[model samples]
Target: MNNFSSPKIILLEGIVNESGSLHFFEYSEALPFSIKRSFWITEVPQGGKRGVHAHKKETQVLVALKGSVKVSLEGTSGSKHEFILDQPNKALILPAMFWSEVTFDKDTVLLVLSDQEFLESDYIRDKNEFDEY
Candidate 1:
């Protein structure tokens, strides 16, 4: 029902039939940015958290392949957005320079799609370091 107040939320097109349900994205059309790398995060213990950082030059799309995820994004300007992604067709778009924290529910699997490859120097892992930058 579109509970997210942030415009970063994107609802992907899905098809359901007797076989099952399918959700897909076209790189040049549906996605806001082209994908350069993709990865999956799973096996997070209870009350587990991740992504307490921000990127310097990367944008990402977070999708819940299974279960659910609570995502909180805060910009340097003190603006914030919170989202709960429970459906496979729902995704949250995170742009560069916004700090984010993702908390996972039990048995949740998160698929992350990035616009850039993994670069150590591009990560602002410290909240203080991110704020000072």
Candidate 2:
């Protein structure tokens, strides 16, 4: 665990046209795991925040679909990382057991895809609880 590191950010190039822009990601090359579920967080207040837990057995990739978000990651090895998702094409990968916190910019739209389905037992809601895992 001492060697834990935040997964590298994956940048998905988008094609822009007169009508709109298109973006896509493939699990085989863009993500380390297949996406089993997906969710989004939106309409966050100017200073609002979310996510202060670590997953027990799920991996996630997060993207800012409309606005910007700041993500903080804490590893079991006591390593810390912070990333800003300001563009729709950029993403952050969070593997299992990585503690994460999110601070959203006003009206931010964040999308997250999980490698596993919703499972209460797969979440560590408390920092101390996560540390003990």
Candidate 3:
């Protein structure tokens, strides 16, 4: 798909009370796709990287749970974008066919929600392969 759009960042609804704060997500209201798998990235060393690939049929949303994260994306049309996720209430939506690179700050914990399950055929891990995808 050459008509890929930019990544979207949506603010999730949160409630703050005298005790603490709570944030929740529902597929019908918060995400564009239903969640089929979920995971987290944590204990990343300084200057480390993750997500140096693109999914062919999976859409994902990343939420920073502890620290900050920087996400860089490149589309098939050669467009590039960058975003910062520093709040748990904020979610970054990543559609398929976009190469992504993620950098984490100290103690950063990133929660990833995906619309598809793990499939080796769904991943494009090389930049050249992704460009030709």
Provide the TM-score for each candidate, comma-separated: 0.91, 0.90, 0.93
Error of 1 at 5 (Å): 15
For candidate 1, lDDT tens digit of each residue in 1-133? 1122232888888899999999987754446466889999999985699999998888888999999999988887888889999999998878888899999999999999888889999999999988886
Native-to-model Cα distance after best TM-score fit, residue 118 in candidate 3, in Å: 0.6
In terms of lDDT, the poorest run of 10 residues in model 3 is 1-10
Residue 131, candidate 3: Cα error in Å is: 1.4
Candidate 3, residues 73-98, lDDT tens digits: the string is 99999989899999999999898889
**lDDT of the structure predicted as candidate 2:** 0.84
Error of 2 at 66 (Å): 0.9
Q: Candidate 2: how many backbone clashes?
A: 0
lDDT of candidate 3 at residue 83, scale 0 to 100: 94
Per-residue lDDT tens digits for candidate 2, residues 6-45, read 6558898779899998998885555656678999998889
The candidate with the higher TM-score, 2 or 3, is: 3
**Candidate 3 structure, TM-score to reference:** 0.93
Off by over 4 Å in 3: 1-5
